[model samples]
Target chain A: MTDTEPRKESVSCPMDFILRMLMGPWTTYILYNLKTHGPQRFGELKRRVAGISAKMLTERLRTLEGAGLLRRDYEATIPPKVTYSLTKRGHELDGVLGSLAEVGARWEAEDAAARSQRAAESKSAELRAAE
Target chain B: MTDTEPRKESVSCPMDFILRMLMGPWTTYILYNLKTHGPQRFGELKRRVAGISAKMLTERLRTLEGAGLLRRDYEATIPPKVTYSLTKRGHELDGVLGSLAEVGARWEAEDAAARSQRAAESKSAELRAAE
Candidate 1:
């Protein structure tokens, strides 16, 4: 059966669906790869998405595809051939994923400072508690 | 003591910190109001940020402030005047949020269709199992 049927959320918050879809494990990264590469095979995707396990990649791909943010096509010929690409709707999310990538880069650059600050605060709070 | 002591994360993944920060419960909406309204008081903030309680707002505010995304100032006057504003670092996150908002709009528009698709797929899978 075709998976592009339509999926919606009945979460408490109206925006929960979007948040859940984007913030789920490994979603942002998957979308980022699709946005950058246009379309990719399963092996290519697994390699491109660093730190993702094959099982995890497959799960996330299924999740995103179910959400209509991705399209997965299966080829009857060859060794389990499958290709993943973004739908028109999915491509529309490119700008959003681009912004997320930019945010990720900025945070990576500043992670050190943020860490040191957190450490100092934790230490100070502990000292206060001891006193 | 100053709350904006520069809190950071030491998550296993580099991008995890930003994702954790932005994908937190109320971060996007809090930042959204700050972006739209410039600076606002505690009550104003609580009211403007829908579905957020006083305690959650306080916690989220503290978290964002610690992350250097917000500045919270308290006045020693009779009425306990407090105001929150985005710092340069925080305001810099606006473009990222603008894109998120755009993505959110898209999802909200198509949520019904997505939901129907998911339901159909689930029902079909169940039928195949029954057969």
Candidate 2:
């Protein structure tokens, strides 16, 4: 049986391959940006992702492209316009990213409600103490 | 607007939170194992996840539990039985994980076919060279 050690090649199962793809730093973020905002130039992606270094972002983008998860279109202009977008294979991740967004949104709301409830309880306790 | 820089507190959106959760090393594997195999003991989980240290596995489990994504059950026995499983909230990730698996399986199949084609091409080239 192939245990779950992450191997770059000869991957035994699809789950392992996908996990490795998703776990790379800023990988999903890049994918999410492309999926949500559509194709973007290199600079736009950098600004949108926030805090990702130029070198790091470039590396991530290249890696994704190598994995066939994204496409890089280069226009030879004065500065060489480069736009990145998801490939058909890459777009298959739409369902997964969307579901994650749904869950994340729900959890954020629940956490907010819990925080408000805690604040209310603390305020009531302060009032009781004063009384 | 909240850009995609990871913040531990006051997360601005569901997608960011979900991205953070999924990007953690061995996080998805743990979740996938639990989702696929149902509940498992700590030892079983460690073995199944492959290459995860006991300390790291414990930490991942604790974090997931704290986030209300999984549950830990303890049995009072001589050996102190402990089992881990996804919570109702954790189970919500079913769609995301399932979709990822689907994509992975398809990619894996395509990759295998490509590899075989390349090998066949190489063999034919060698035959031509010999002739």
Identify the candidate with maximal TM-score. Answer: 2
lDDT of 1 by residue, A1-131 (tens): 15852332221234444666777767767776777677999999888777679999998899889878889999988688899999987887666566666776776667778889999999999999999
Instruction: Summing lDDT over every window of 10 consecutive residues in candidate 1 chain B, give the lowest-scoring window.
Output: B4-13
DockQ per candidate? 0.19, 0.51
lDDT of 1 by residue, B3-112 (tens): 83233221123444566677777777778778778899999988777667899999999999988889999998998999999999887767766666666766776776
Q: TM-score (chain A) of candidate 1?
A: 0.67
Q: Which stretches of candidate 2 lie over 4 Å from their true place?
A: A1-13, B1-13
Can you tell me the CAPRI class of model 2?
medium
lDDT tens digits by residue: candidate 2, A42-78: 9999998877799999999998998899999999999
Q: Which model scores highest in DockQ?
A: 2
| DockQ of candidate 2 compared with the true complex | 0.51
TM-score per candidate, in order?
0.62, 0.83
